[model samples]
Target: MGDEDFLLDGRPHRILSGALHYFRVHPDQWADRIRKARLMGLNTIETYVAWNAHAPERGVFDTSGGLDLGRFLDLIAAEGMHAIVRPGPYICAEWTNGGLPAWLFQDPSVGVRSFEPQYLAAIEEYLQALAPILVPRQIDRGGPIVLVQIENEYGAYGDDARYLERLVELNRAIGLTVPFTTVDQPTAEMLEAGSIPGLHKTASFGSRSLERLATLRTHQPDGPLMCSEFWDGWFDHWGAHHHTTDVSQAAGELDDLLATGASVNLYMFHGGTNFGFTNGANDKGVFQPLVTSYDYDAPLDEAGNPTAKYWAMRDVIAQYAPVPEERPSAGSPAPRFEVELDRAAALFDVVESLGTFTAHDHPPTMDELGQYEGFILYRAEIDCVGPAVLEVDEVRDRAQVFFEGDGIGVLARTHHVHSLSLPRDARGTVDLLVEDQGRVNYGSRIGEPKGLIGAVRLCGEPLGRWRAAGLDVGRLDVVRRALRPVAPISGPSYRAGTFSLDESRDLFLDTSGWGKGVVWVNGFSLGRYWSAGPQRSLYVPAPVLRAGENEIIVLELNGVPHRPAVFTEGLELGHTEF
Candidate 1:
């Protein structure tokens, strides 16, 4: 199909599209998701090209396994739908620092999403790296990608038209053939700020009110009008309850937009998980680590299962748009055998055997020690450390201090850092545990360094002779093979149980009783889960499931072996009581 084939009014088109990340759902379920989008009357599949997900490290990129973007596009094309690829060097999808690689914070001088020479240069490198995969698939290349987005919601950040124009120029320089666009809230100044040449401006409004369109027109009347991000659903943080929107209200607004011949894209038809440390925080002055499950109260849930909202929106769109004739199947087939995990190896053993070095006078920073991301361990022998105050000049977020083998104290510096009392000890061997919660992904100062930026000191002396442990926990293979249990596996340890299946199908790994940590099926990391509040289980795709016996492992932070953990056919873990 030609570019106009997907367009509504000589414009690239009003894609009643849904946002779904390829990394969030199982590779096996990609087709299912696209089919569901089609059934929902979605003619386009809009997705943010997550830089971090695609390139976990600076030089290393993985499109294999579940990170395959090309296969994802192929699936979208197979469903006869157009694709809107938002390849953001900075995608603020509630991802850690808005999809910025955590390692980028390692560079002290780097400022993200700005016109800063260092920042822009890094972004250019990222684009160049990703171009080989995307450029060939642009609409001109006979691929489904029709419209490419410039930056995500730029108006929310700055009104720098120069920066916006530069971004447009950057994409063009990289050979992105699709017409370009930018998304921002419907404000006069923001619309003006995000506008560029041959660049369409889209407003993110909650309703179908023409006011937002009028605002865009008043500012950039020469460009195509669109709703770049329609908030079909909202996202939930770690401690908040799940957010649910009124489908009827959303449907009414969507119907109104379509009736008026307007083009709109649902913010997320499916909001995938912010796997690993990829979850980001908003600029509300509150550190909101996105829940592992990014279901986002979307038309499609995190597990790629269609929600009531999906049907409601689909019915509404079917009235004005041409929807798929047949509905996609609801759930994947059940896996043949539900694998069982019995016990977890101890983490202390791994630490003890990691080999020791001479005690240091001062703690090391993330850079000096040749480490890039995650936690650092600082150990030292101090004279005044007995019952002395342990002071991390600036603990990025969390620190656990162990005095001579005993867990002395835990200090959470999420708000402020200082004066954490140390346990009394005659023999002065002090070990400080520090974890980098990742830098803020959105808004101003997004490039702030996370983790331990400086040295760790006790009283007035700098800590030295430290052996740092790099907990750059990103992949599932590492979580499984790095079986050194830090603390004891407590509470009810759910033993892996096996169940035979005739065909491959999707299943939800129930995590109701487990406190938190990660889950793996046959070595596939489903993502993290916490019993603290909100999310309960992780989704396992059928494609990853085998016909024979499969293994399921749950690395529970606070779980004791009790009943055998069960796997069900549905995506909702609540359906199966643990």
Candidate 2:
């Protein structure tokens, strides 16, 4: 990876690579994803090793199931494709906490992505745990992993040399013998800030801009010029329009970059789903929540099916690289049908198991309580008259207001709504069920906390005596068969239904006209959905289904009349005019 022109085994290697996250796709679908990339003419594969997915808690690590890197890499090697491993203790791959574990917040005073002793120690500890499992798979040890990336795109954040130097040393100290690389904006500032003394430098861009490539050449003239993250497509967001990159333009730009003799890596040749609450939010100028479907509008759709973009890129890339002529046929399209949900339940039936109660003078944020994903409840007693407005200083994501166990209104960051109408009544408990959709995984607002991190005022008076609770339900099994009442669609409620299929295939559950909530099918959580105009269907993989029966449970936070139904029609991806 370090040689001029990036010679591998003393031979010229044009790294036609594509990014594919193992955690994003199901464990059973790893081979299919890599096969699709290879069929698209990609000779190399790229992936970010999510630290949080591997170790959800402090001092604990999980590598079985979807977190199994060894099995994933072995599959890649078996396919005869090379690998570029990005083990960023800080991989900003639209992952929750930027791939950093939530348990790290047990000590919030520690500044993240910095040279602070605590931050460095945390990174080192994570690397130490991962190194043993990772090193044996490196090419040096006859594994497929050839190149390792340090902290991801750090120059956009700051120019911390000690941090970069220390991380590079740590990789080496932990037996990473492969060449280490750093990617940046292709400018002198980013190159200087993100690059180490001996590390290779690569440019990241989404367009066919000559100036960007020139900038890379100007800085790393002695080495191979490559586009580490040649952004072939984009990620979608809630309330924002669905993102779709022009495949024609992308194909032309890819050809242009290859003509310049630079190796290229498509950011996501196959965009996978951000299953569960693993999706990360974004903050460029406004706070936007990332959709559950990481479908990145890439060459391959979320379900490992190729798109028009995939075909276009394949035609152009085959002209440059010696691609395979025999490609796998796109499997038979899955049949679509309507299924009626006949059963139901309420969320309060299991609220006891959903959250841990705590008392506070003021509401605390998710970070304050060491929680990463899911919702939190804030309750305080206050006297208010009818038609009065309740002012909460800040709502990081979304909140549902409840007046003495009755749902009243909602506060979401997307709509920029803050104040909600209060009921005219005597002093009572004011409950705010706040949902931390996701923390911004990229940009300046990277570490913003969720929940009511500020004061609550009733009309004009400060309210006191608060109790906060957290609801991070990844599964609804604790009360799977627990019987509860079937309440209205409004308020926080859980609905249950069962459907049977003689045969199984990939499917989507339409959530249109439904309130915001989380969906669980056969004990696996599919992620979040909001009625906010964009994503309306949740991707349910085939393996999760059985021959006889299937079950679905929804925990909706808002009170609205909605029936559980699914259709095979096209997905309702939200669209924006811009």
Candidate 3:
């Protein structure tokens, strides 16, 4: 890089890039997304590596299918575009646990993003495993990768300069030769704390491009200014309105950033699905979990179709860079259909055979029981005398309370409701099925464990001798096997349906009628869908469907309504707000 500009082949070069996470999009569509990105007048594609996805378990690491990082880079190179990689052990991309493996926090001595020996050692192991794939694909090694990022947004989290230094050393030790970069919001304190010696400091903001870049210039001095995360739009939560940014205004901001001779990367060129239980939550004052759709309302919509915003942004880019003469074609219309959930199995009836429950004198948290994601059931023999109050010390996310196979009520952490009135003279086993609705991905509440924490009380008296069982929604083979041709059951039941299709086409399963539950198609999880608000349909990619017949299973925590599961040709993300 030159004193005031980025240099390529001894000449000035500006990086026009957009962020599209490979793990978020289907592997079959990676090439399609990359081709469209190139057609949009971009020269580079950037992505954040999700550590939890790659290394879900402590010793297990996966790089095949959707998690294939090498193939993603190859696709970018094939599109003749440069690449920038943010390999954060902590990437707060609204992902579960900020991409840190859940098992990493099981150890008490390991301090996250610190100089703690155990944490650093874990980071080193991850980098060592990841380097071989990236080392051979770097730009210096005749590959597309041009820049490698250090810890992501470190300054916003902590001021451990030594930790940043250790990350640099770890990358170098892994044979990474590309220029290192760090991203943070443009603030004196954050930039100073997140920045390290010799690493290019880039700002992450959506507005005030000139002012934000000036702040970056003050810190970077001689280096070329860049906006690593130009957030075009925002993500949605369950109850909130869908987020959107003004097309004209955002395009003008892009023009302003480019006018300053600054490089830019659109935060989400195409935001895809959170699929399964990978979505994250936030707890700043109140706990709000992210919706399943990671569709950040970008230029490319969740269905991979280019929107009006795409063309406006393209016009802005065309003034500065080359774009395709012919605009890309829109995606084909999605197919619509309906499937009736005929078979059913109640969770309460099959809980005993589905998994084993360990007897505990006191209820243990999901993490304490070695269970990370999914629901944990706590059952105890409670003798209710007269009208009494039932309370749990804390309910992480949400929980459904049952007594003698009857769902009395629901307690959600979001509303801070933990107690309910029980029936008079109730005597039976009390069941509390707590669900992990994605871990917090940002702020000081990042690592807070899920499930019921502390005591379960009846009339202000603590209950004991509880049996805890983990019902991992991801591993539901037993539940599938246990399904029978039965009538609709009440409360927290699994229902199955089958439908025939002539061809595989992208479709949306509208869950507006259903209360709350997770959906699985042909054994592959499409993630959770709630009738609450914001997102009402789950995007079912064509790849997960079969040519002839497909089976869908819904674990409706609340009883399934009489209406059939409807499918739509388009997405309905509810009301939008700026």
Candidate 4:
């Protein structure tokens, strides 16, 4: 970074980069995705380090399996490409808790992303743990990492200069020698607020490349112009229509951007699956949880296959940089099959075996129990007889109400339904099974806990002495121990089946026929799927499968009429605009 250009070894360099998150994609497919980026005429591959995924719990950090950060970067370097690492204490990349660990917010006193001592101390602890892996990967240290990013998009969140300053200092103290940069939308207020005097500034936008970069250049008058996040496609919400952008229109914009002699990084060269319970949500006035597939409608689809957009962008980039002579290889289609769910077990039959319940006078939120991601059961013994109004002050996302071992009704936050009428008597044990769809990944609601919030009331009276149980559902042994070969009753139950594969390959579990729930194959969670329009299938990578017989267990939260698990060669992601 210099007065006029981004200098690499005393010469001006334009970064032709594309974003591809390693956490989102399967570990086995990292090389394939990176190679495809090179095929698209990109010289650099950028990614964000998900703090929540790496350090899921405090004092417990994992870099093994799919969460291997070092392996991802080494693969990029092996392929002769540069890297940009954005390790954010607050990323806001539509991830769970915006990549902030849930335990960090347990103590309300610690003001996160601010200059608070407790919060800063936690940030320091995280950086200290992460530094060992990232320090040796910097470009100066014979590694591929060229530029390291500071707190991501701080201007959109808050304008705390001291907070941003401390973050930069922390990175430097950890021995990161690469040049630092701050990204924000191309606006005078954002560019001025997010960037420090010496830190290089970059803008993030999809269109109007000439104007956005001009806006960026005005603030960074002496530096090279760059669009850090060129959002060529968009993500899909649970019920919203699938989003797409015109290929020709986007390519024309790319031409206009290249014509301005500005550097650009496509926001997503490959948008992978939000595997397991890692998908996030958004809430403006309405709360909308993000679907299982990140897809993003990028050049590469969710299955990592090149689309028309890939060639369109490749042609545009060829004018600026050299593209590979060889084209990308086509992916093998998934085999289509259907397996009958012969075994079934009701959730209530196994809820007790999952975990022990905590006794509370008033129902506690998910954070209070140190349970962040899954479903929590708040059971209370209530004495009543016929139809009554059951009210939960706030349902985090969705709740299924049960009274005296009978299915009553559901209360959903999306529909603004807090009160529902119970058809049966509110006698014996009254249960409210709450599901944590996802934490708000952006805005002021980021740190708010999941599960049942506030008081639980029946007939205008608050319920007390509740026993709450957390169902992570990721516990294979517990679920295996609890699941029995019983007849399938209505409501929430575990549906199980087995199928044999001749060979292992990428597959998609068509979940359009099923209701809302999570799916697991051979104990590896394929993430969540819903009958709710947009996303109709869950991506199952071949790595999770074997040549022999394979088992799949589905925890169908809302019961479906049929008990058949279907497979598809391609993703049946509802509406097909992307």
Candidate 5:
């Protein structure tokens, strides 16, 4: 096929694409996923190459264990479909620190998604490393890679043309030959600032707004008209109810787009898990940690199962374009097992003795290591006699204070810096627990400092001689093996039990009764879920499950022993964490 065949003379190229993060879905399911995309009449598959996923440790890349981007691209090509690579040095797809490795924050000089010299140098290294794997697969090289996105949704951050140009030039210098594009809301100023030569500018629209299309046409009349990110569903954050967009309504909107001769890309064809500490927050000043399961109520659920939305979208696309003769069948069988553990215990009860410190002289500040994600514990003793006010001067985030092993008060940074009055009787020991929650992930002040920034004090005296405890509980292996807590299995602990199956298929780990924590199978950390608010259960991909007895471990925060955890054959658990 010729290049012109893909793009019409007057109209924009009719590219129906879907965004799927490679790390979320199992590596074995890559081909099946691409086939499913094609079956839904999708010609192109857009994906974000998560920097953290490929390079979990700084300077140490792991393309093994289902993270092979080359293999993923090959699968897309084998399906005879095009690919749009969004290899964001920083991809804020609700990923932790916007797909950035937390270790990067260790260096106080590194600022993200900007023109900072040190930051740009790191970005250049990343591009140079990733270019060889992707550039050769570009459509110009007879491969399926058609377009490369510069920075994602830049209008929400900043409109510096120089910054945008730097990104385009950086990618081009690293040998990306395909056409380039920028995705942003349909606006006049954003259009002018985010546009580049040889790069098409597309507007992001919602609710079938022809006015948006008119605005894009009026602003950049010569550019391609496409919906870069069509919101088929929404994402869920902690402490928020599960979000569900009307799939039928979304299908209708998609139909309207196809009828109007517009090219559209589903923001998420399959919303996969944030996985590990890669989940991100928004810019609303609220630290919204995304649920472990990124099942954004899309066509393909987190486990790669076809949802009702999937069929609806498939039928809608069939009306406009030619799909495959038969949809790809589900892949091989997944391993399931139950193992009775010796016992499970709480961490608080296992410690031999708790350490004590003075809260009068040593004050805890968020500036110790700069703005990083997670919780920081500060312990100190107060010398004041009688009742005193616990003042967390400039508490950048949230703080929970306990005086003499008694809960004193709670202060939310979103609300007030100083907590309520604390009743202290003649020089008592005090402990201040502060959780960073997370930095804002989107919008203008994306580079704002996160976590606690200043010191904690009481009654006009700075707390001194403190012990810092970092509570980054998501690291499964580290947390499980820590010298924290382990108890004898008094009752049930979702023990690993195995059953054989002739063929591999999707399955769901029902976490109905368990409290919030992480789940691991065959040594792979599935993701984090909480009984409080947000995600209740998790999607276990079949590729990760084996034919024999598979190992499963559950780390419950609350530890309810009587209630038994269950499993199902498909991804249809209905419990919401609202």
Candidate 6:
């Protein structure tokens, strides 16, 4: 028991594991994904719990919905699989707020991933609420959870022993007595910082770097050597080309690890969709935000089909943890079709009715207002003439500037246009509708403000009296829609239509030529779509679609559809060849 080896049910484990976040994958497909993982000769399945997803707000927590933690663990047990749960106050799985509840910012001094008392207090509240659910399912209590990880990747951040100690204590206080472990890059500093006196220390890497793997064993020579996270593939950013990991090369590396008698967990055996605004951003160097799909080019494709990586790895796994399972059926083709959304409605007309507006003297970020995801509308009157330029500061992700009701200019998170030139005689109610495309979930800029966090000026003078209204773009009500003749549309407009499908299967909404925006099918948010090349189609699962008529809504950032209307068809992921 004092040894460093991970003991599952009092026995040493050479666990073969694969990672899959339940929050990323649709709840309905949990069984299929888990089953496929097991079939691939995996003995254990790993997942990171999203705190923001479970307890979105402060006091109020929705453990149900798609984020039913209890149900998820139960399903894992039912599938005859063991689990390794990573409940992160800051998981950093490329998730918005790093899986942290954005409401934590209600208190200005709440520091993240540290021993800040306020932050710890919030973590305590979350653990107190969630631990009971998880503890009951621990292996000791006859459940599937074996290894419960501490605050994820703490070594990479800092050697905050106090914070790490408290996290361990929190889990223990909740009666979680399972063996604990942590994973970080196999570096001297990371291993030293990540390792507690007795806990298992594992290395995480995506390559067959013998030096790093050897370094891990040298640093952590006590228990079983494990590659806690072998990144199967990389994640794609909003404007960047999709990333693909070579199947054969990766499998070859995995083979070497298996030969070393090391336990392994595929970083993402099945990379699901980011769905909604839960997708995270990377601030390593330049601000690069992740795309909607988490199709990590893993063994399982985005649609949960076996890829070349799948078969290649399966062959390697057989030599080690042999298992016989039929290659799961290929993913259903995402057939594309066209629908004419003749009904168009402007959000400005219905935003006032959807939610109460928050008024502030100066601009405040979404966090300050307890707003998490969606659009924040800032309205202010500007008295300017004679071709004066208008500028807005800290335009979070994307902003559509309007003079009166006509578009003046658009500002993307990339800071393409900081100031807009005033049209000949521009004067009226100035509206800056800013969209929080995503929170920078990783690197230094974690707390980057959203909406207009700085000054708004007409040329040089700082302006105030900001009227901000948060648009819950993810949740839509029966917004008053009207029939409009086929004509060109200009500003941020919401389009709706009804499409009938007799046989429902996975479908791809092709948004090519249409301006960037979000897509929803039958009221289910399918995530964002940008015509900036790379990703042009949004995957709409069949479960959300009905046999009769399915309701479709498209939130066009700027309703300039090069095509007559957005259509559905095959998925054409990656950057479009110029």
- TM-scores of all models? 0.86, 0.96, 0.98, 0.98, 0.83, 0.95
Residue 533 of model 4, lDDT score: 67
What candidate 2 gets wrong by more than 4 Å, as runs, is 1-3, 385-387, 484-489, 576-578
Clashing pairs in 4: 3-222
Model 5 weakest 10-residue run by lDDT = 349-358
User: What does each candidate score in C-alpha RMSD?
Assistant: 4.4, 1.9, 1.3, 1.5, 4.9, 2.1
- Local accuracy of candidate 6 as per-residue lDDT tens digits, 317-396: 99987686676778755555678786777767677765567767787776666677888888887777677787766678
lDDT of 2 by residue, 166-202 (tens): 9998899989998788999877898878887788889
Name the lDDT of candidate 3.
Answer: 0.89
Give per-residue lDDT, candidate 6, residue 566: 49
Return the lDDT, model 2, position 165. Answer: 90
Name the lDDT value of residue 187 in candidate 4. 88
RMSD from true fold, candidate 6: 2.1
Model 6 earns a TM-score of: 0.95
Query: Which regions of candidate 5 fall more than 4 Å away from where they truly are?
Result: 1-13, 55-58, 101-112, 328-342, 348-377, 381-384, 388-439, 444-451, 469-505, 547-549, 558-562, 568-578
- Considering lDDT, which of the candidate structures 2 and 6 is the better prediction for this target? 2
Specify the poorest-scoring 10-residue window by lDDT in model 1: 569-578
- Top-down lDDT ranking: 3, 4, 2, 6, 1, 5
Question: Please, what is the whole-model Cα lDDT of each candidate in the order they appear?
Answer: 0.67, 0.81, 0.89, 0.87, 0.66, 0.80
Which digits, one per residue and each the tens of the lDDT, describe model 5 over residues 94-138? 776566665565567876766777777767777887887888999
User: What is the per-residue lDDT of model 1 for residues 1-578, given as tens digits with 9 covering 90 to 100?
Assistant: 12222353344555678888887777776887788888888888988887877666678777896788888998888888888888877778777667776677676777666677777776788888778878988777788888898888876777666677777778889898777878888887777666666677778877755777777667665545678788888776655577767989988888777776667788888877665555665546555556667777788877676778888888988887787788765555443223345445533334433323334345555544544344556666666735567666766555667776566655665455554666555357776666555456678746555545566656656655665554433333443455442334533122333455565666777667666566667766676676655766676766767787777666453444443566655544221111
Judging by lDDT, tell me the better candidate of 1 and 3: 3
Residue 316, model 5, lDDT: 89
Worst 10 residues of 4 by lDDT: 479-488
